[model samples]
Target chain A: MKTSRFALAVCLLFPALAFAHIGQGDIGGGLVAGFKHPILGLDHVIAMVAVGLWGAQLGRPAIWVLPVTFPLVMAFGGILGGLGLPLPGVEIAIALSAVALGLMVAFAARPPLWLAGILVAFFAIFHGHAHGAELPDTANAISYAVGFVVATGLLHALGILIGVAQRWRGGAYALRGGGAVIALGGLFFLASHFSILPGLDA
Target chain B: MNHFNAGFVHPLTAFEHVLAFAAVGLLIGQHGLQKAQFLILIFPLAVALGAAGARALPGLPLVAATNLVSLILFGALTALAKPLPHAALLAFCCAFGLTHGYANGSATTAQTSMLAFAAGLFAATFLVVAYGAAAAQYLLQRKISWIDIAVRVAGSWIAAIGLMALAIGMRGGLGR
Candidate 1:
């Protein structure tokens, strides 16, 4: 009983290390790595969340429309990157996406639906290119793609859930405040890209 | 593992197969159970037939491409939330089942018992389709506005994954 208790305690305490073997191979590793890619990047997170915030602010069809539009456009962009096609200033554009979308959320800017979608779609290209270009040669490609897309969708859902705050009093201001922080973060990323912020990589 | 277990676990193990199966279920389920009952039966039967046929047939080309296309087709259909004629729906489900099952069959060894493997495959396929249908039916019956939007979003995600996989495949990055 004591030995079993000790083993159970060790398992609980070191679960990640214990389960480390699960993701060591091609499929599982690819899934885990792909899921982590967008999430680990602060720039990606903020921009994706800002999309949801802006969508929620726009109300009605735009709320669902923007989230739906993003993944499809992003996949097209991924195809380009996978094909080794070059898109200019990808990193800069990615940072700019965060800045632009963040500001849209911060200012509660509600543009025409088509314009908003076009803007989101434009940014999605940059984000997708970065992910696709970095696709590991060793991992299972299909699993990796599924992992990343699902992760990206969940991030958008998170932003949408946060945007749900719009229903209450002062919630709108809170969302704007969140948007401003995201915008500032984007500027920081941009500055890092430009070498203005030394020692910090975006 | 026994052939039966191998066949049963095969579809669950493959991400492409799971996604395609789920998409079919969701699309059919979105139309309601009464309309979906026929399709639900047709899909698994087609899978069994495809798996059995794989042994006698010369290797089919573009199995991977066809599987990815099925994902895109079924997912896009679900996302659109548009109704199809019964015949069209049946044809789509049948095609999806056959191609995916053939892919699964090609993976199995010749020594495996065809009867046991096909039975396992059919059972697993039926369960997946049923589960997907149930989830979609539950959501639709609830009549909540967000539930409808959520299903569409899920559909789009599946389609996006399919498109991305196709892109990767074009680059020769995807392994069989």
Candidate 2:
């Protein structure tokens, strides 16, 4: 009877064992996760969209240059993060991006193309490094990059749509109001990361 | 079946190839059908020649460096959104299409049926380009500048991926 019981247990356990690692090392799974990384993060969303908003406010060449500069610089940052290079205050910098870009949009600040490009690129490093540091060992590097880049671009697009509201007088005021809200959110994120607020840290 | 599958799967499997094909389409769409006439026609022909050349000369260097470079350059141009002259765009497309076709050709084997492989490759490329061009043309027709700008931003992402691929290649070559 005991032998039969043992045999039955083995049969039952074998099925579970076969699927123990299912979805654990899949490249496609990793790609999906990477795609969701930016979407899942509030900090990333605010800053990425703010970039597009600011670009639209600035208009013309700034519109293209800001977005163009970001991913290129961010890739460098990701490579650095992948190499295990330590970058201090990445979280703080990410939070700061939201604040700065929000204010830029709110004020309708029109910096030169070079300055706008530099500012966006500066903030992108922290965001990219954060995402890159979390890469799965078993993930296809190229696919993961493609996934996250697509996600980031989509976020920027969303911001551009919102920023287009600035083309109208009432819409411009609404965008400014939205920018203020985004800036406030960034400040809250900054405070929370620093553990300055008691209940807010959670 | 194997030849057809191999050809069909090759470009889809490579992010660089997929992005490059889409970028070409986006460019053509942005410039409009009239201005991109030469480019639209010459690209596939160059691709066919490149694939044939690769098969004919098996010992040719297939370093993939050119592919990375093309990805970086064209992606940047797409983001810039400036219209390139037809002659320039045509030359660019021919050069890139040839190089990429060569890479795609390397995937085939002696047992592969030439007709099947060519058909599969042609179908995939045609579809990718056609889809991108149609989508872009639709947005432009609707005057949806937001979506258009989004496409341009996507080009930046492609360039970034190219940079990453380049870095990876360098790291692999340097054994670190």
Candidate 3:
């Protein structure tokens, strides 16, 4: 059981770490590189899932709207970041986004759809802004945005689909269990944020 | 165009471009001929715009503006039911697309290579859409929530990264 649990935990984090583009090599590798980033990074993988799961937890119109809205808003925010706008507490806010989102899942706190949308959009602004700001001039902008945003939405849909089993035995419990996992991940992120761990600082 | 070893162009030249295209592919479930057709059309147009923008404006600080917008919008997306003002946003994509194109106008390429470069991008985009659609389908068949939690954690982390960008940009802007 412990072995399977370990495997499951690894699966949980597989996407995000796999998709880290911080080390994205070259400027013209184009699609080949785009194809590989999410495959390799765990962070990208998990972020995708959280979108789906949270979308499902909120349910209803949010089930569809929030997921769609996030990427669009995120892309805009990314453009802002790319264009060099001024906002405050980005790093802290990102960490907080992780923590707050995880807690929402852990506590199964279901805010209204509009509120949920607002919450995700706030974080997305930060998320999109950062990615956009970092876009290399040598790289193609729209393509880059497409890569990350698409990966993000798929992950959300996966979460919702997984949440579907919630109708079956242990499904809701499983979701909550997933939340616990998110919370733990948040703790690791926090430790890394404070520079207290030998973390990837992503 | 710069000559690379083995007569094959270096791949990184258009690396992130792949991600953007692939991302859209992955997002919409990859179903129907319409989606594929739409991607084929929008992608090229977007690329043309991006290439053109890259030619006209070359500034690293522009990311600051895009990043700030994401932060504001992310909050709304998670808790809201309203659709974004589609026209303005679509216009943003067009403008944003131009910036991308203009930025890379100087990279390795054929003076006549716009079509080739776009072809490369389209191929990459197709793969991502396929992958995303496939993965969504696969998950629908799985008994998993760990992945969901993992994704949420990542979203949070990304948000944090954005926050950091905001601070750094402000600091740089203030000359402190």
i-RMS for every candidate (Å) is 5.4, 7.7, 11.6
Measure candidate 2: CA RMSD.
8.4
In model 3, what is the error at residue B144, expressed in angstroms?
23
Which lDDT tens digits does candidate 1 get at residues B1-176? 36776577667667788888898889878999997788887998898888887877848888878889888888888888888898999998888799888877876676889888888889889999989998999888999988888888888888988898888887964443
Off by over 4 Å in 1: A1-26, B173-176
Instruction: Summing lDDT over every window of 10 consecutive residues in candidate 2 chain A, give the lowest-scoring window.
Output: A16-25
lDDT of 3 by residue, A93-191 (tens): 655666677677767788777788888888878766666565544443334443455556556667788878667557877887786676567566667
TM-score of each: 0.91, 0.78, 0.48
Local accuracy of candidate 2 as per-residue lDDT tens digits, A1-202: 9999999667443422332222221236456867898888898999999988887787776777777778888888877776668899999999999999888878877777788887888888889888777776656556667778778877887887788898899998888878888898889899999889887751
**TM-score order of candidates, best first?**
1, 2, 3
Give me the overall lDDT of model 3.
0.49
Which of candidates 2 and 3 is the stronger one according to TM-score? 2
RMSD of each: 4.7, 8.4, 12.2
A178, model 2: CA deviation in Å? 2.8
- For model 2, the DockQ equals 0.21
| lDDT, candidate 2, at B34 | 64
Report model 2's interface C-alpha RMSD after superposition on the true interface residues: 7.7
Clashing pairs counted in every model: 0, 0, 130
Best-matching candidate per DockQ: 1
Segments in model 3 whose C-alpha atoms lie over 4 Å from true places: A1-45, A197-202, B1-176
